[model samples]
Target: MSEIKKSVFDAMPQDLSDEFFELIAGNDEVKIERIISRGHTSPETGWYDQAQHEWVIVLQGEGEITFADGRIIKLGVGEHINIPAHCKHKVSWTKPDEETVWLAVFYS
Candidate 1:
């Protein structure tokens, strides 16, 4: 078997919006997705509910995320946090002048 495989973003569907998602890994235990989101402060940006447990880390740029409990976290490159499944959360804002890259790993 080949020891290396191309990452999902190595070749992704370009037709996606400024916010793009690519599944990078999945198995019986976990699923990993990479996200590229830009200009998150737009009126269109809002909250989300995850079906599975997730942990996300900022790979680039800066942003803020808020939880249903009204707690907010400001994240920048190299910072990471975990979100439990079904927890309501949202990306409040991201620098429009820069891209916000996130490495999100989800597990059941």
Candidate 2:
């Protein structure tokens, strides 16, 4: 079998939309993906309530996450967090000039 190899910080599409996500690998109950963000934030009126748990690490740039309970978490390169499923949270801000590369593993 062949293998796939790529850089998480590689250049993104020149005409990308709001943000970009790429599926790397996964199984029936778990998944791994890469999220690339630049000046992106969650919707002002909503928070993410996912069905799967997420463990994420930032590989580049910086970001902030706010929880429903008024908790704000800041992350820089090499920082990480584990978000439980169904937890209400939203991305508050992201660095605008550089790509914020994230490595995330999601599981039920």
Candidate 3:
């Protein structure tokens, strides 16, 4: 059989006006995606209250996540965080000078 190889860092766009999301793989119970951000943040009045649990890691650059309860978590390269299902949170900040690559796994 032939081999299929891919890199999470590939296909980066030059214009980052919007955050980029790419689905790496998925199944019925779990989904994996790669997100690239540059100084991106959720809307001021919006929060992510996901139905599935999410575990995210910062592979490059830095970012901050803010919870509805006023908690802010900072993550840099090689750092990670687990967001429980239905947890309310939003992205507060990200490194503007460089790309903040995130690998996220969402599972039920």
lDDT of 2: 0.90
Please provide, for model 1 over 23-107, each residue's C-alpha lDDT reduced to its tens digit, 9 standing for 90 to 100.
Answer: 7778878988888777755344556887888899998888888887899899999999999999988888887766777899998
Give the alpha-carbon lDDT of every model: 0.79, 0.90, 0.95
* Model 2 lDDT, residue 7, Cα: 80
Which regions of candidate 1 fall more than 4 Å away from where they truly are?
Answer: 5-17, 41-46
lDDT of 2 by residue, 1-108 (tens): 557676876756575457888898899899999998899888899999999999989999999999999999999999999999999999899999888888999999
- Models sorted by lDDT, best on top: 3, 2, 1
TM-score of each: 0.79, 0.92, 0.95
Candidate 3 C-alpha lDDT tens digits along 1-108? 546898888889888999999898989999999999999988989899999999999999999999999999999999999999999999999999999999999999
- Candidate 1, which ten residues in sequence have the lowest lDDT sum? 8-17
lDDT of 3 at 32: 100
Query: Candidate 1, TM-score vs. the true structure?
Result: 0.79
Candidate 3 structure, TM-score to reference: 0.95
